[model samples]
Target: MAVLAVVSVAGLIVDDRVLVGAPIWAKSLKFSVSFVAYCLTLAWMLQFLTRRRKLGWWAGTVVAVTGAIEMVIITGQVIRGRRSHFNHQTPFDSALYNVMAGTVAVLWLATLILAVLLFRSTIADRASARAVRIGAVLGLAGAGLGFLMTQPTPGQMRGTSDIVGAHSVGVPDGGPSMPLTGWSTTGGDLRIPHFVGMHALQLIPLALMGLVALGARVPRLRDERIRAHLVAVAGAVYAAVLALLTWQALRGQPLVHPDGATLAAAALIAAGAALGSIAALRRPVGGNRAGTPERTRQPVG
Candidate 1:
């Protein structure tokens, strides 16, 4: 996928062709890079599942294979200068879309299986374990957002044959999009939240890394209990943000133009996260972390 992304980058620079109002190679690059992240993250995460490790490995394989298929179809569509998602202009296109949808369903189910395994397993680090569990759930939810986009728009439902669904709300796709992402700027865009939510798996872990580094300098944060509490707080905030983005998108509100209600909800989420963090930090640090459950040293596939 990384190699494909490199090719896509070159294509973007040399090819002037446009599809769906974006660079022809743009979606190819985006999906390829995203698959790289998704697959690599899943591979890293599967190592944590000491219990049902075999099942976890199988699930990861399913995710990787399906993801590869999705990328292939997307790139194939790009080469043909046709949009990959929601393109029902011809029988062939529709069949390809159906196949892609089937593969994605399999991938989603595999991811869910992996989530269950992770929840059943334990990690030595409480904070990491918590982060992993929460991240898995959020990641599933985020990826689930893709299904929301598959539903036909109101207009499509009313009367449409060439197209079946849309990612943009209150506006047609391929129109007035945000640069780079091609997200709708004129109205609500489901893709915005979808992107944000799907990355929780990586983002949460990355946040944990940052917190660990911070702990080296801050004496109080050195307590494992304290770090775990802070991680939980961060996870809560991240979940809230995901929910906020989803709500904003569904309301037909552009990300750049959040309504008063959206702003209020965001403010509440921020305030809640702040209070939660403070409460966590003020609590007494407990028990020696050396007695914590031991995490096995395992090589990532």
Candidate 2:
């Protein structure tokens, strides 16, 4: 993770621009490289945790698949420049990028489906399961809405200053037009929905963790005794913060503006540590046999 972070920072320094002016190939390459590096780091961390706990393999698999799709998309973008076959560009690059994007979208849908399945299994209890299911449904719906927002509106194609931005690269004169709004063109293209949708992947999982943690506190749930209450609560708080950020994005708020996402994330991290300490104190101290009931011998009497 540290290595990826360093690489991403280095890429940002080298690019020295946001989403514009850089050659199409260079821009795509940089973005994809940074994104893939980050995703892989996250996947590794999640895998490590899952291995230790022996839980949530399915969730880990979803994360791994998501990372793989991200890599493939980045590869296609880096190789293909900005043009695709359907957009009237050269067939090879265009076809590959288009196919890659389509495949990614499909995989994203599958990820959502798998999340629902995992939620069901993890929650187990009826009420907790229902809460998780609702959160998953909201996340999927939000993603669909965001996808629609990525398409070019009819009026947007004709002319609009809103499409222009500080970092936009205009299409080469007479070059093949991009069918999508932000990718093929330049300007103030609203990508808020896309941002929201992508973060949903994180938000949904965190929400599930929260639900599970809360369920553990319930008197009736068997899994309530499971360690990790703090982890679950911390996850829930983090998810809530992400959801707020998503709401801000959906409202077209600027990313850098103070919306409290950072503070919230920090708080959650601190709380997680505290909760973890508390949970550790409550854990069973000895081997399984020590906690099991001792049977008395009857034959001697």
lDDT of 2 by residue, 55-165 (tens): 445554555565456555553443444432123234555455556557556655654644445453434233333333444454455455434443444444666523312
Which 10 residues in a row give candidate 1 its minimum summed lDDT? 292-301
**lDDT of each structure?**
0.85, 0.43
Best by TM-score: 1
TM-score for each of the candidates: 0.94, 0.43
In each prediction, how many residue pairs overlap at the backbone (N, C-alpha, C within less than 3 A)? 0, 7
Quote the lDDT for 135 in model 2: 43
The regions of model 1 sitting more than 4 angstroms off are 288-301
Which TM-score value belongs to model 1?
0.94
Write one digit per residue (lDDT tens) for candidate 1, span 36-72: 9988888888878879888888899889889889888
- Hey, what RMSD does candidate 2 come out at? 11.8
Clashes by residue pair, model 2: 84-94, 85-94, 163-187, 163-188, 164-187, 164-188, 165-187
